[model samples]
Target: MSYFDLSKFPPSSAASDDGSVSSLLSISPRSSRSIILDQSFFDAEDPSPSPRGLAEPPPQRSLPAINDALYSVQVNNRRRSTNSNTTTSVSSNYDSDSSGRSGRRPIKTGEMGTSSERESDGEVRYQEKKSKPKPKKKVSVVISGGDKVKRNGGIRMAPLNVPIKRRLQTAAVLLHGFTIPLYTSLFWFLLAIPLTWPILIPYLIYCLFSEAHFDGSAPRRRSHFLRSLPVWRLYTGYFPLKLHATTSLDPAKNYIFTYHPHGIISHGAFGHFCTENTTGFEGLFPGITNTLLTLDSNFRVPFYRDFLMFMGLASVSRRSCEALLRGEAAQPPPTWSAWKPWTWWRLVFLLPIFHPAPHYTAPTGGGRAITIVLGGARESLEAIPGRMALVVKRRRGVLRIAIRENAGIVPVLSFGENELYDQMVPTGGGMIEKLQMFVKSVAGFTVPLFHARGVFNYDVGLLPYRKEVNTVVGRPVFPKAQMESPRDGDLDEFQERYLAELRRLWDEHKDVYAKGRLPGKEGEMVFVG
Candidate 1:
């Protein structure tokens, strides 16, 4: 066998090879004699100087020819030194023993050296370890009862959700439709029988006689006995409105207020002009009694007629308009000693009845005025929630009314009125549009398929949503009074001036209330007949 030199192997492999040899020798390297033998008998420990001198190499130690040969020599040398040291320790131990029982004891092998036995032991160990099982990991407990567990383990209960304003609005709507008419009829009936029957009875007889016998075109004295009903009060209180006057309205002068974008039903007109709900109208412009004109057909409704008349709501017919504007002021009863009278009662009795003649006349010396809703039914259909698009094409009728009456046309712009109800289907055009027009034409007002909220729930009902309505009364447009029919050019000029004033009103105050809306459409005015 070729003897191998020890220095050519890597350090880790050489050390491992020595460990295997000690297992074959049946001696533990940990013994004292093994330590001594390793220190004194290894090749590195040979102390003799080289034959050439202390620094000279050995003369004929040839380099190993093959790589394996070099590795084998290194491994063999390491094993020889380790085995020799372990054997010395074992022999010394045997000599020192008093009882010779070494042959009877089992030979101990190192863990790494005995492969088959370790494999068998590993199988047994793995089986035993597998059978023993791992302990379970702890899981967090969530004790859910009344306390709700938040994602982070905190507890909270849900909050209550309710709409209080919607309930109030529903109450208002119910009061307007049901309770108001009942109360007004009772109050008016009591007053007519007890005190005013004599005057009212004669006036009605004269009105019937004149309307039937004479040329119904003749002028007549209008009564004020039943015009102070609480229904109007209830109607006005339903909205948040403020009446601001740029200039004092002269009571002696006749006037016309042309309300624009006639919302749903001219609710703003009913609240602002016909009723004294916003501010004390009698106090604001003393002696100035205003009437909200409606379609003439409204006077044909059974109970609604009396209720409307009691609230100072008259027909917009030519006869009704003239009669309301030219009627005489009510004279106070002679004698101041009757006991201090109720101011509201006295005003109700004494305020002038504005009954102008059936022919639309320029104000007497130019003072009489009439108010018409410029947008009419068509614009009411265009009142979409959160946006306004006026439908006023060929709407020079209001200009004509202003010019013919010589009444300074005051344009009233109502913001937030469109937001009151959410229309169910989109409005503009289609089958529904045609149907809406047909119904409006026949019934005098179209019922928009709209929903707001129930008194408690947000899902369904006829009550309007509790949106704030701010009706802005724009600056008055005083067109040049013409004696004869207004010429085509003059009518065009009046329309332009009126439109400009309306646009200015919207620009000045739209931001104050309608801040969330897209900017008013550029030149978006749509004129209608």
Candidate 2:
């Protein structure tokens, strides 16, 4: 018999009572012998075997049997002591040991077999046991000023340290989004005459000199000159923007950066391009001169032309484009002119012949770059926060410009650019739409009925909401020279290729930076020249 055989029995305590008990009985059944167990048997209970019809013995029944076996051993010892008087005590002790050994052997064997059978049948029998629960600690609370008060049965509380920078940033964001726009509008309205006059004067001059000789430096610097005013900085203080660039851009390389989804006046573009201290423009792209292009009418004012140039702005005219592109290395000091006297007539007459040295020789050299809001003012009316909808319909002029100038095209996608202002209605055609289009065609920019947070209130005016702006610069697209105008078929193919590259750039990094914002759908490069 093997140890696993449950039917095998061990030696009985009754066998020790008679001399007739054989040596075989003393040896017990071979199946009852203990052996080193398999590790798997102890680790996991196998459930493949089915249980037999025999039910497990009740606890009460097993306990009485155990008690009886112990009682019998005591009774046999007592009888042995009486039978031999002097030697009886000694014999009784031996008999008691033999009985105890015999009884315990069967009990141990039975327990082992039962446990194994139950485990094989997947029936686990756990002895009922309960553990005492741990006592709760007493909590104590300290009260300020004169008394140390004990509370919550003496429980101790840990101190929490809040980060000061994170708290301040959150506060700044709330203030910009909720309180700045109202103050900005109020300030603008109060000083509208003074502000409007300065801008108005140069704007008229630019229009009068529309076909006149072009001098690049004066006009470009005047556009951003308003930033120098202490009052203007106060207005922008409510919504401060920080600019950072991943790589340095060479100024000598003429670049045409196409900005998308024209936000209401593109406050982001203005902040980044027009101001030096705010955007850190000089630090990021060292040696790369940038001009944020504006409509020709912007430089028409008398005082505004000088102001715009001071602000680093220039006209977005084709003539202005050629002049800047063909401009000299660095302007000669104003005093070192061949035709000195610096009169308006002399400056105007000498301008055409006084071509400044080329700012850029090779496309790869350090040169000036132009940033065009390609979506234009119509796109501004359609601008929705978190979604980019470019207005490329019939807008092949930019492509032509790229090819003509031999400039590399850099598509710029700005996330959260549109989140700044809430528009009058949803972005499509209607009576309002016709009016906006007419205004754009005549005035160069549409007046968007937009609103954002005020300086002292949560709503009202044309300021941008306090949302992070992430501007991604796509890889450059080099233009191929063509002797003649591109056919419709060739144009379509080129546009398709350009759009594909743009979409690829958006797809790759959009998830990394714009996880929460709505994603742009399959963009249609609608040509609406």
Candidate 3:
């Protein structure tokens, strides 16, 4: 809509020879910036993940600040009476014809043309500063007696030590955190019953053929409402997980994040990478879409399958990994597709020998990343609170996938992961350890005989302890001079370089991140695969 002054036309500034008078025209200076910037607009629908709901600190910009701010001239559109009916330049506010909010009617882009064009159009020259909004001050109040009272505060969050309100909130969150695992376990039991076969059979068959589970169908994971549920925030506050980037990762490159020391459930990986809402990971590493990979066996279960998928969990199995890397319809599991239905049982029996189910294998457009708890179940055996023991020593599963996919690797070291649970791992040959190993050997996964503090007390439950878990993502290690089917020597060389990088990362910050660990030496680590 074009804006103009509404007033009786003033008499012509000059008379014509025929004694006829013309209305005087008023002109003003105004900037039409929108028209200038219109041709430079670009499409911003990039696939890169953007930051959402994160309270990140302001970035440290390297560019020098501008010394002066320049603003374009605008216009005041109200009309007024002048002593003479002549062309005149004016720079004063005029009354509005409406209910009267008194402010200059700023010039808008596209409203008028060039200065000469505007002069011909009878516009007035106006000079005014651009309007600026006033900054609002944030006030903090201590909630005592329900009356607001200002309090001085520092950059740190309030301590969660003894506040009754905060404690109650924590208790609720602890309960909510249990809901997922409890429901998944419960679904496994309920769905396995013969009575539920009619429903279970159909769903399982559907999952068998459907590609959604592995085709990057991640709408659910991106749901801000679900991902940012207060429960996760509480879960985060419970151990109070923190994610760090030792070096920034380029969004233009794909990555395989190999997480170490898969303590118990690999809770560190879940809190940091599984949910973008939980950690504001995009704020830390913008444009990288990180999906946490889990056992394909997890997806074989009924409700549990959907639950994991909703949380953006993908199968770590070979074909599943390959499918994700290629971003195509998932190729069916080898045994399932290759073996006869009558031979399925025997195929399951031979699974361990044929396929190490929980492992992943990459792409272009280059924004994808998968978080692999590289230690798998073996690391759970070495999980000792306050100590750094990883089964990554001989674990080349991730490297194998990395080499095949040619994806860069990053070692993700999550300190204090083991401290969250106290696992009861007896010596190697004990009956209990034997049973655990048997389960792992047959089923490909073993539940750690672990415990953490309960909601009501400081002992005996599945809840992780209230310790600080800092996950630092080390620098990317790109394998150089590699072949599609990499040689063993080449793989070893890359692994050695990766190990050095992992060590460098730990040695550089272990003192700070593992600060409150049980008074251990700097390099007392158990890194076995």
Off by over 4 Å in 3: 1-181, 184-201, 208-211, 215-224, 329-364, 518-523
The TM-scores, one per candidate, come to 0.53, 0.52, 0.59
RMSD of each: 21.3, 21.0, 28.4
Q: Write model 3 residue lDDT over 326-384, tens digit each, in one string.
A: 54422333444433332332243342323222332123467677888988888887888
lDDT of 1 at 449: 72
Candidate 2 C-alpha lDDT tens digits along 63-164:
245335445545655565567572322112112234353211222334335644634432211111234589976553442211232333233222233244
Which runs in model 1 stand beyond 4 Å of their true positions? 1-170, 178-237, 328-369, 425-429, 519-529
Clashes of each: 29, 59, 15
- In model 3, where is the ten-residue run with the lowest total lDDT? 62-71
Sort by lDDT, top down from the best: 3, 2, 1
Ranking by TM-score: 3, 1, 2
For lDDT, candidate 2 versus 3, the one ahead is 3
Lowest lDDT 10-mer window, candidate 1?
32-41
Better of 1 and 3 by lDDT: 3
lDDT of 2 at 67: 34
How many Å off is the CA of 330 in candidate 3? 13
Question: For residues 1-529, could you state the per-residue lDDT of candidate 1 as single tens digits?
Answer: 1122223334233222233111011112233111001211132333432221223332233333232433443455456547777321111111111353221122234512363553343211100011346896534333212212222222222213324442354465666655446755754685567676544444334333322111111112223333344544444555555555545676566666777667665566666765553445556556555667777665544335444554556567656555545542222223443342322233344434332222322223333344567677777776667677786557776566567656677777777777667776554678887898898889777867766544443335655554567776666787788444788899988888888887888778777867756545632334444
